[model samples]
Target: MMIALTILALCLCTCTLAGELFEPQANAQNTKASGATIKADPFQQRGLCRRWAHQSTVKNGTLYMFGGSMLLKQNNTVQEVPNTEFLQLDLAQSFQLSENTVPWQKPKINGDTIPPAFSAGAMYSGKGDFVFLYEGQTPKNLPEQPSSMWGYSLINRTWQMTDRWNHADENFPNRQSRGASVMTSDGNTGFYIGGLRAYENDTFKGWYYGPEEQFTVIDLAAGKKSKMERLPLGQKRIGPNVVYLPIGKKGSLVLVGGTGEYKVRLSAPVQNATKMDGINPDDVRLNPMSQMDTIWIYDIDAGRWFYQTAVGDKPWERKNFCMVAATSDPDSSGNKTHHIFIYGGGTDYMTPMFGMNDKPFDDMYILSLPAFRYYQVKLGDVKPDARQRMTCHVVNNKQMLVLGGHRVNSSETLKDCRWDELNLFDMNTLKWQTEYNPSDPGDSKFIPNPDVIAALGAKTQEPALGWEDEDVKCLFTGICPGEQGIEAQKKRSNARWRKWYIAVGGAGGALIMALIITMLFLRRRRKENKALRYELEQLQLYFQYQTTGEIYSSTGVNNLISDGDAFVSEKVRPMTFGERVKFVFGKKGSNNQEIPTIFDLPSEKRRETEVEKIP
Candidate 1:
């Protein structure tokens, strides 16, 4: 019984806890009733493969997108064509292009060309109005060195070459694959972080590079030639997502989730390879295979690393996820809180390389710094598929625009899928609204809208709220610590059962005491009756002697007399002790008053009455 009550308490407690965590707000019904409408873009279903690139700069309300690789295939062979031309898209000209009406057309500039095709390392300097393009593979028959860094100025409408950057130094590491390079606000500096580096020889004995020491600060104002910061060699790590966190009156850089380096033994067949043979078989240095969800913060002012708390429930540990930071804020001094949005990355390490046929995630997560609150923004019901290497850009403070990524189908074929549609989520509402081309005949593919691209460069309406000092306490308090509240509620429920048991036990004890007392009283009364009977017998014997005066002394007669006295005592025995004295007094009263029990007294009265009637 006790165990059942405990289980019941636990179940109720769990229900209450769950309700607290995921209960829908009462205002949610009101918001739904209001019914928000989102306009869809006309360019959602176009079968175009556009490489993800940053918005170069906003000039005269026109947003410019530069060089990106486009899919150009022929004869069953697919090749990526790098675009050098600048496409100018007017923000005011945004409208549905119809046959009768002319919409704002994106005009391509012939003279303004960017350095050839690149996939990953592209960043824009908003203040300088220059786009920095660096370190992407050139179309070559064999593996070639990536040696060029190009800059295109939108304001001057010209491309300039830097002599210092052209000169290669021994300290400067080689270009890496899937590496990230971002421009600082000063517009003259670019920070480069981790990716994969080329293996020089077959032996693993060669110096391990491309992981820990792969960070360099490029001074574009100094003609791109900058000295590397010499620091102690840490563990080799890669695939790190880096973002600049704006500190109060200062700035800090934060890096989240990357793989590290470790030693692995190579088989003889693998060891015989050119690059593998260079390394000792016993100590083959390889990129560390650990997936990191850890966030490391680097203070720009202090030149030190400070670790922050991990955000979110165990996130899907993967690489190449899309991340973007807030660029502009119309409210307050600037974007108060440096928010980083992360979405859609691969979970399997071997999957990206070996092509594990699995679906990608569609979940969106936000990391708000200083407060370090990780909010899992509800994206509603979105089916997951492969979306590795997709691009994300912040369109104002509320919405993010996501672009093209690879989708793998059941046949194990990789198809270049463009989410030609833009998904808009209001930060305040946390509800998703999609915009796409409604007129398009093809099925609408989800893509980040280009209008969002325009919005990214626009100033935000308000600066985001940063984490205050009190947020730390608030965060800890909000967390359900070991289900303490649940346990307390369980105890409260159990208290009811405890009260019931005490009541029942008290009633049962009273009843048992009453029954025992009644039985004892009845037993004592029976003993008293027996004692009164003995006293009555003795009185009867005394009465017989007084009534007779002289007695015949014969054996038979004495026996008879004794028996008769015993019978009279038994018959006339008092019902209670008090009754014995009353019986004795009543017999004496009848004798004194000459009671009518005597037959001679009645006959004498009858004879006297008859003589009086005859006269």
Candidate 2:
């Protein structure tokens, strides 16, 4: 070791350009590492061949893909090869250079901790340290036990299985159907409803039961396994995709279209479809409602299930497609409604076993919120080939990166996914793009699809979808949070009306009282004036009689006799009412032989208090 170090030191001293030598060394350090554990260049060692049904998820900007089947051609017959190679891709680095396909990396993990997990659900927990796999098919293509929860730790690169309901050091429960399951945005909880199989299976006696009667919650953050109060009776499904939107504290799960069959039975029509591989178009017996294109929603906070139907030309009832959601940013582009994108799946495996045969149902649809209408997205000139069982991961809140799917029918050529391509969809414009660029604003504004609008017709001012359930409506629009929902809006409306009612009622009552008081004032003034006019006429007549006749009185005898009798018979008038009012007020009573108005107070107060005279 010392001799090798001395020679390397001597070579470094002899080199002319040290900076150039170090540059390639830095690149080599990333591509080729310490041992045989890592791969060179593309970084992906497994899952390079044609495959499908693999599960994928993104955590901390890295895409982890694993567990699917590979299709191989041997002489005259098609072969189905089951794969268990866990791989990853650096999305931040891959999309920046981004050619025909996104790049993938293989992390050689050493363990036999988990069984075959192709049709299982994948979720990240504890802030992205571990990715948990829900129940799926075994290597023999049989259903895995519902009680067993398998998890892979990214930090340790090891897999370990635990009891479903039992938790000692870690948390797991929340079984998902063969369809699909979704976790909360914070990575703490999982929400799923209507399992095709039982989570606590004591015996594998039945393949399907009467529609699921349990709504389960696998709360990793709280470290408990429990069931919700909602038990909706609906058709059982396989390969359905679920989405968890954070509407309230518990959030809600949207159960979109899935394969409506519980068990696929191979018949003559399906037999001629394709000579395919593992779980390829199973002779599954579909439920009635599956063909009806139903959407089931479970509101976690309300603990209830709601049923809805879409009006647009919804893609024929199919499964094994990718569905992803992103909130809208009206300030830049798109409407204020949230959007869920559905793309690239088939009703059955219709790809020709030998060549590129375009399958039916090879289209995309958009489920825009608040209006819950389906719009067939107009695919641009460049579109992805028809495929099934692919995983779509949303990136940077603007685009969805579709990765890793295969046509089971194709043996020699790759039709569904190109191993060197990046499949991207711009959410704002609802357009498909081969390259991903952050600076590119996909669309300045999103206009509604005319076909869907025509089908939606004129709505009756109520929410088209969430009209039945307020909480479910809140999940989609500004209905529940930030005073943006109907309940919040109604509360505000009632408050405003209440204020107006109080103000108008109070003002009207006061005006009515003022009118009554004014009428009484005028009536009292008229009555007093009438009496004053009569008294003034009598005084004028009495004064005239006294001027015409005279009274002479020498003593009491003469006062009683002569014109005194006539003068006595005449009526005399007292002082006018106006003069009496003046005498009582304005200090006139003090000058007239009457006690001063201020001194006329009750005896005790007259001497002690010097009251001021009236003005």
Candidate 3:
């Protein structure tokens, strides 16, 4: 019997699991059969093939993305070759253009005179429309830093050389694939943070150790360089990723997660130096590898560092995630709140086996401040399989467009190959929508390089052409060329008023409810006090009559005509009709024991009393 019961239970469990698996599909089919198709976004398109080292920058109504390496076949060898040219997309026109009808036309800038192929050491000066090109790896075996600093100007449509052009100085070290630069809008200032430099000793040939000596702040306007600060060093140190936050007028720069040294080194000293008090050179040791989860904020005006505390339900400890500043305000404040959106990168595991299973991250997160909260966005109800090194860009206030990255799933043939799926996340709704790029069918196919997917939108419809007055105004207004244009001031004002209304209404409602409750309690207490006083007064009168054996009436009448006894004298008489009634009710009846009546009470003559004389 027990065996039969167990079999029945197993069957029931299997049926339940099967029901759950097919329930969603059944519902979806029913909805589809009713001719209700899910809403599809019109602007979705397949991205172009590109490399990780490409440079992307936004300018007047256009997003200009330039050269990076792409895999090309030469003879029988497949190798990464640098892209010579750049592409420009008119964002204003793109936003208004229908995805089905209009295809992205890549316009060549400076056709044959394009700069040589490079990667990593490129910086952008947002205000002047110039990109500062410096050190990067070449197709040749040599890791090279450009002999001269090249400045490409967007306004003049030309490259210019300044007196400030020079290679990395002794204190300012440079090497390819080590650091990145971020430019502020104030024109003259920018920061060059964390890169590698070559170091050599007599015993060993020179080798490149990354996350080198110190970060440098380059004053392009002044043509001077200074060390920003040195990160704490121990063991397993890596370069830092720096980005600018331009929401406020006096904007600040943010440094996200990076690798740091933790190990103590042990070595014998060759010469006698001032012995450090806590640190012993002879007993040197290197600590374990640790990834830094700390975020450092640099104030441009104050020139100081302030730390923000870590937040989120499950905070991520990661480095090299893509960080982008969200320029549009969801709160409708013309003063756009700075939002830093971070996605996948490599992680340090602090173990002897490094890179054994180190894959890129697919998780997406956003950091919003003044509130200082990190929300792990749910892309779908179910978590996606792990992905790493993905590229992401904010398309607008509503959506963040994400492109290819390396996946961790080992069963697939393209184990370390790039992903081809185009995923779109609606920031407002936190929903993930995916579309397979028809141009690039699968991971194995030659897909667009991850770096080429720059943030571009539709162009304005009214102007009809790229070179028009309305077109210029639309771009300068901070609206992407296509989709619904942003009305900056009006939207911000409405958001501010809405927040104010919620706060004020909440406070007023609470106070009004408290006042009403207090009034009701006081009114009920007053009624209870009146009823209690009436009962107490009656008790008091009854007690007085019982103790004194006298009644004093308000009409100057005494109800108890007492005999001359000590306890029952005329002086101790009931004073009022009310008091007399109390005295009569207080006495026991002579007839039946169950009933006590005033008429059955003992008469004054039959009552025994004793009188006490007082001086």
Q: Which candidate should be chosen as best, given TM-score against the real structure?
A: 2
Residue-level lDDT tens digits of model 3 in 1-615? 999999999999886666544433443443343233331111232222223445555455454555444432323333334443345555444232212333334342331233455544454544455655544444333333343345666655554443233433634324444354576766667676554443222332332444433455666663344434554321123335667765333566777664444333221212233421111233322321122223456656535344433333323444445566554434344423344666665443321121213434567676644334455554555434455433445454345555334354222333132324335555554556443221222222211111211111121111111222222223223453442222443355456556755777867756655775687467545644543343334334433443454344433223444222212222222322223221222222344121111211223332232111110
Give lDDT: candidate 3, residue 339: 48
User: lDDT at 18 for candidate 1?
Assistant: 54
- If scored against the real structure, what TM-score would every candidate get? 0.50, 0.56, 0.48
Task: Give lDDT tens digits, candidate 2, residues 114-233.
Answer: 435344444444345777655544433243434445667777766776435432312222334455657788888765444444232234333343243235576655433445333443
Candidate 1 wrongly placed segments (more than 4 Å): 1-64, 72-88, 91-114, 140-146, 163-173, 186-188, 198-208, 211-213, 220-225, 230-235, 262-292, 326-338, 351-359, 382-386, 409-425, 436-615
Please give the CA lDDT of all the candidate structures: 0.41, 0.49, 0.42
Error of 1 at 282 (Å): 19
Worst 10 residues of 3 by lDDT: 448-457
Candidate 3's C-alpha runs over 4 A off are: 1-50, 72-77, 93-114, 138-140, 146-148, 160-173, 185-188, 198-213, 219-239, 246-249, 264-292, 327-338, 349-357, 381-392, 401-424, 433-615
Better of 1 and 3 by lDDT: 3
Query: Which consecutive 10 residues in model 2 have the weakest lDDT in total?
Result: 579-588
Full candidate order by lDDT, most accurate first: 2, 3, 1
- Give per-residue lDDT, candidate 1, residue 416: 51
* Number of the candidate with higher TM-score, 2 or 3: 2
